[model samples]
Target: MSRVSNMVAEFVATFPTTLRPGVLYVSGAYSTAAHLCCCGCGHEVITPLSRAQWVLTFDGTVSLRPSIGNWTLPCRSHYFIDSGSIRWARRYSEPEIEANREHDRQLLADARIDTPGGRHPLIQYCRSVWRRLRRL
Candidate 1:
């Protein structure tokens, strides 16, 4: 499983929903943008809307856009597949999610907020929840 896939799985598990078939699409992870990154492990991160399972699909696609997020990172090694190579898909197990959570936590802690895609949405969401809970 790829590191990004695992991190995405943890994000899904943390935020559960009833939507089904949620597909996780990853674009270029080696762009000159912000803090985005590519695992370069020949895997794409995908998660269905049903459960907390984040799958590493090999048959996937990468979209590099400056509007939303930094698709890729500055590191060349992060570029796993070609620009438009659809990869495979596999469900990430529970254990994988846990491991990824820890890793992601560390990543978030050290991430730069100035970067366009450096701040993970999950981290911001979690911070909002914490603030709300504090208010309550």
Candidate 2:
């Protein structure tokens, strides 16, 4: 698909109810970034900020280190967000995907953050519980 070449970053305290395509919503308060799939697929990609995952660099423009690979998504788009520009990357095969997964696993192990989506399992669980309690 002919994808959009550029993306706009918006700072938000909290993610909105929905994400707009090509608009990267960066929330420093949450240390997270969210956006629609750049490959024209409407999947919401939530990239958590962490040592084992993406490292966001924002200076007017934004760059997310370690290109994003949507292995779980059907589109499986791979690209680098460089200075608010979308740099499309070559598609990875299943074997390559497995290798990438292994690399990610090693990074997670080294960082001792073994939860899914690069988040601490206990922390997320506790946060969820607290949110639930707040709702009560």
Candidate 3:
């Protein structure tokens, strides 16, 4: 796929229902960043902001961490969004894709386990119920 050289960043409170190619729409209020597929496939890509997910960095230009891999798309494009440029990454093999997917799943699980405040909601609820039963 051809590299996208002319990307522009826009900040909005709410993302537009319709996305336009070549524009990265960022919404800190909503904690999301979106853009059309740089592969010119016309697919809308929305990256949610989270510690375990994509992080948008803006320093006069916009960049996204961990790259965007359109694995489910027909195009299956993989690239990095950095400084208003789309740097194409080499296509991954099936095994590589599966490994990456597993890595992402593990990362999410770790994040949930390591949440700052306390144990995960389910674990906390279980412990609370156990304490109440013991008190009874």
Candidate 4:
């Protein structure tokens, strides 16, 4: 994995027309972060800020949690953006990638279930059945 040095953070109300490598563009208004692939692949990575997804932290320096895994890219680069630095993560096997994808799907599903609008009817029925079965 190639290390990206001299990373910089820029706060923009909207993402620029063209993204530049080595710069992380943060849009608080849109709750998103965008940057070119740190591996020098030049692919634009747009991470949405949410409780179920990437969480941006600013403590004098910008940081993101749960590492960015570009599994779809040919490079399949994986790294963490921390304090304006690119910390490379170990490459994952195909099985590991599938597992991670499943985990992310479940997290998103759970988040939707917990939202204020109310649980999905199917999910609510499943939960009720499980509760009743557990009492037996």
Candidate 5:
């Protein structure tokens, strides 16, 4: 069941060779988080930490900003990580997904966080996502 619900936060300098379910591994050095999909599909989910993307919050428990929508995954799991709990969100239509994706791309493009890095970060991110999907 995707109801494996609560996730334990483990701070790491980088991701480990294998991912375990119900554990949100956070890398402060990389400003990223990774975990097996909350839907129990075993697919890995990586959320980049940034103002333009997901932000990490640590009050009592850890939380990731926004929601995670695994639309490409077979389960299409959608949920929020709030204070270590998985709060499932409603599923979106294909059109809504595309619109949201495009909007996110626009946000990255607008940020121009890549100018200093030479290549467009959005492009690199999209390419990495494409490669991952291709494997899927």
Candidate 6:
């Protein structure tokens, strides 16, 4: 039954792959006027309002705006996922999210006063994210 066992193992591994969320990465590095959002902890910061959702499937279909549409950023205090399907803020590690926070700050700084490269850098970054998502 070695063959059977191998097949079962493969199937089990592929199961989660089939259900894996198509979103590869999201850029939480944007700025908007709606920054002050009540963190469940009662604090707030300048965070993105929401973001579009792109769904990549194992079947080779990239849905930019799926039936569910894009996700929502619950203020600058939470991370929106699956195009508003899921909202999370405390789910991520403090350190890693700090990096996202810094990145967002830099993006705002660049986008604000039309710094050097201007918004081109932010667009490039989002484009890079799109490309990476397509690969999966």
Q: What lDDT would each prediction earn against the true structure?
A: 0.31, 0.79, 0.77, 0.78, 0.79, 0.31
Clash totals, every prediction: 20, 0, 0, 0, 0, 3
Per residue, candidate 3 scores C-alpha lDDT tens digits across 24-102 of: 9876555668988999888888886666777666677878888899999999999998888889899999999999999
lDDT per residue, candidate 4, 1-136, as tens digits?
2446646877776899988888888776566789989998888899877667777776658788889999999989999988978898999999999999999989888888887673344344434543553466
**TM-score for each of the candidates:** 0.26, 0.78, 0.79, 0.80, 0.79, 0.27
Q: After TM-score superposition, what is the CA distance of residue 55 in candidate 5 from its true location, in Å?
A: 0.6
lDDT tens per residue, model 2, 1-136: 3366788888776899988788888765566789989998888899877667787766779798899899999999999999999999999999999999999989878777445565564345434543553466
Local lDDT at 92 for model 3: 91
Error of 1 at 117 (Å): 14
What is model 3's C-alpha RMSD?
A: 11.3
Candidate 5 structure, TM-score to reference = 0.79
The C-alpha stretches of model 2 lying farther than 4 A from their native spots are 113-136
Tens digits of per-residue lDDT for model 1, 57-128: 222343321111112323223222222332223434557646756765564456544346564444444445
Whichever of 1 and 4 has more TM-score, that candidate is 4
Better of 2 and 6 by lDDT: 2
**Which residues of candidate 3, in runs, are more than 4 Å off?**
1-3, 116-136
Model 4: residue 126 alpha-carbon error in angstroms? 34
- What RMSD does model 1 have? 15.0
Query: 1-136 in candidate 6: lDDT tens per residue?
Result: 0100000001111112122222222232331212122233322222232232122222232212222211134333334333223333354456766765576567566566664545454455545554565566
